[model samples]
Target chain A: MHPLVLQYDGDSEEKISKIMTEEIIIAGFGGQGVLSMGKILAYSAIMQDQEVSWMPSYGPEMRGGTANVTVILSSERISSPIINTFDTAIILNQQSLDKFENSVKPGGVLIYDGNGISRHPERRDINIYRIDAASEAAKLGSAKAVNMIVLGGYLKVKPLVELQNVVKGLAESLPQRHHSLIPMNEKAIKRGMEIVNTVHEVG
Target chain B: MKELKLMKGNEAIAEAAIRAGADAYFGYPITPQSEVLEYLMAERPHERTGMIVLQAESEIAAINMVYGGAACGRKVMTSSSSPGISLKQEGLSYIAGSELPCLVVNVVRGGPGLGTIQPAQSDYFQAVKGGGHGDYRLIVLAPASVQEMADFVDLGFELAFRYRNPAMILTDGALGQMMEKVWLKEPKPRMTEYPEWATTGKTPDRERNIITSLELDSGRQEKFNLKLQAKYREMEEKEVRYETIECEDAEYLLVAYGTSARICQKSVQVARENGIKVGLLRPMTLFPFPKKILREMAPKLKGILSVEMSTGQMVEDVMLAVNGLVEVEHYGRMGGIIPAPDEIVSVLEEKFIKQNYYG
Candidate 1:
């Protein structure tokens, strides 16, 4: 059996079983790779032989507009892909932060990139973390790795999936021609992991 | 051999069609379903399996192309969303009337008109009751997951050719857009020879096959209609496919199909956790309706809730199937809104458990 599958066994640690099911919403502007973040995370879960679903807003809503995707990863079968609330919300911009902050479940995690947010997350019941993913990607000389950076921050907090699986997922999600950029993406993820700060939390 | 891959439902359908030895795919681009065409184009099935993929000028042209190809005994299909499907209704009716074997996929979006580009099962009545004009029915298969979306392509074609009729895959935007792991079937080689009934250039020793829906003689047309009815009856008898979970000792039953069925499954889990005896009945083939199962289970259930994305389409079918043996209620969210599992659980409790248990 896959190591990840064994992690969900009944005798596994309580923390592993408690977070076995992760419902996430990633939202941002069209070009910010919000949907791609969700796609990569979903792919990583699939690599671990986990049940996963990724649903993105398509068509006009994705053309120069706010785009979002819902991703669910579970040890068991996922019943529905479309969900109203999320266990985690990865908001990349001010609009996304405003739109999705309230949808995060109480005690859930909300990770946001500080680049586009003017108003901070106000939710008291949820854990909020901020990472400057855009600046990190810019520093790495690849502005497109913003999503990867955000994903790295999410993993650091949640630790639901392993980083090696995420690298494999990145190769699967991107075309072969762009594979050289994987190293840059990996750098961005590590930068995100190092830079994320917890802004708010509940006792 | 089982090869597992993560794929969107739309992409899975396209790959499965090619693997199923589909001869041609004719479709216009439409949201939540464009991946079906996009994947076919990207994969270049023509080069791989010699399957032809064409982007027609419109959905009307696409359905007509499917009709033309199917008449030649080629495994052909077309896919579209709700509004685009409306455009193909005329061609669909002609395909059914002429008794052509083909696949028509509708990745349904919300609708009465050009509704939201989100998932909705409002097309349930249109698909199962024959949306096009005439006394005709297309064998309808409802796929809830990406795996089913892939598997049903071959199943739909098999049933279609078995009865010499068109088969429709009725799915919603959520199922079409969502990504999941799918175990792809082994690729079947494309058919090189045409069947005897096909309009493949008639041989000198055989009578030429004429493909047309128009029967000049009214009496002959009436007889043809009766033959079609008999075929539908056969399908109803033999093709009713469904799955039941925890129905053996359940006080509450939920009837749902496609994406709604997935949500209802979650509701079943939640209700069970709360000590409510809730079961889920998923209709795999919507046209056959799984009436027999419902009729049998209705007597043992305290109440049935028809959960759907539409206001109340399949509920009517449930009521008809139950025949007033139990109280049937519908809880739905229209205009592309999906009801959450918690919402479904609350509604189920209010409608059945609370009223009966606390009253």
Candidate 2:
């Protein structure tokens, strides 16, 4: 059996029918794998038969190497691929944190890697979580796995997509020769979920 | 079951072209739409379906290549962004005059010159009003989602061949770059029979079919022009594709298309939630303009806000269609800045709901 196929409940169709639409914004520097993170999430949504739309900021605005992607996972059909606010925000760098901190809905979730955030999100209505994904990835001896760790933290917070689908998504994204790395990446996801700390909780 | 995949709008168009049994693709790379060419190159459709994908020397060259393939009764296509599309205007005019069946996808960006690479509907006039020099009409299809981007390739071909005219998929940089789920059509086999007008090799059984835009006799040229006009009128009668959302009991209408239409859909949700009765009319075929529907619904509408990512171009067409039955107003945000759904709602309030200033 392939290690990538962790678990298969084959019950996403029944559960996802009741799941509300989740609009997410992932923002960071261009090279931080921000786009890939959103892509993985989008593919995961597809695996569960959810309607998904991934819109990225492009052209001169991204020439600063600043990148952002809006991913909408919905049980119903998505109308606008482009949106102003988000239900959840995953911020990587301080620039992104400052930019998108206010775009989260009042009762939404904000997850950030607290590596260089000078002014953290001060919102009281939304939930804030600080994930030291960079630090955790450094300790894991895989600097490139920072995105996977952050994704893991998000999954922990939401768990919208099941573990089985995520494993399947990893299998789809990674080449066959790199299938051996799936277990390692899965470990990073688990690490993200474990180390993420809640800084603020909305009542 | 249908095959669905998460694909960018540009990638969807490319894949759809291949699956639609396109004979060839000739395009130059440009921002927000370069993916169409890049995707085709990566897919290597030649290997799979004997489809030819080539990066032409220039947009002009690419369009001419499309003209050649289209004239030969092949399902050929070409794509470019705003400035590149401008470069293909001459070729487009020739293709229209020659009455060739081909697909031209323009992923529009902000432009007058080599403007911004961001998404904009500023090219509305260039597309629907005939950007070329001649008095010609190209059947224009505007796709609001990635799914439409895929579906329009097949539909564009069908419509173009039916009229023996040029058809263009007029979209913007946002829809071209954005990714969404798309159910691609099954692979279609390449053409087995050429049209009677096609410039295929002449057999002994028939006269050689000549394909040219040149008509030296002024009387004959005028007749050809009249024929083109008659064909356009038929299209206007048959091909006026649009969608009306929540207009059943609305007092005002929001008219938009493509990316703006998608945003307006959300605006409708927000505005209705706020107890504002507003609906949206999204035109899928811009050239046909859905004028009849607008005319029919005008008497009931308090006002019509034609929202676009331009300095207001489509508003003129809306006004012409309405013909003073009600007020028609133009609301737009230029420079590739996509307006938020709530922002559009505010524009409606300020423009019509607040001041009642509807043109």
Candidate 2 lDDT by residue in tens digits, A1-203: 00111111122557756768999999998877888889888888889989999999997767667899999999876778889799999999998988899999999999999997788889899999999888889999998889999999999999999877888878876769999998998898889889999999988
RMSD of each: 4.1, 5.9
Candidate 2 Cα RMSD (Å):
5.9
Q: In model 2, state the lDDT of residue A93.
A: 93
Candidates' C-alpha lDDT: 0.89, 0.90
- Candidate 1 Cα lDDT to native: 0.89
Residue-wise C-alpha lDDT for candidate 1, range B1-359, written one tens digit per residue: 55788898999999999999999999999887999999999999989999999999999999999989999999999999999999999999999999999999999999888888888999988999999999999999998899999999999998999999999999988889888889999899999897788998967998999999999899999999999999999999988888887676889999898999889888887887799988888888999788998998888899999999988999999999999999999999998888999899999989987786677
Docking quality tier of candidate 2? acceptable
- In model 1, state the lDDT of residue B30: 86
Question: What digit string (tens of lDDT, one per residue) describes model 1 on residues A51-119?
Answer: 999988876878899999999999877877878889999998898888999999999999998886779
Candidate 2 — which residues are off by over 4 angstroms? A1-19, A61-64, A175-177, B356-359
* lDDT of each residue in B52-88, candidate 2, tens digit only: 9999999999999999999999999999999999999
Candidate 1 regions with alpha-carbon error over 4 angstroms: A1-19, A201-203, B356-359
Best by DockQ: 1
TM-score, chain B, each candidate: 0.98, 0.98
What DockQ does candidate 1 score?
0.33
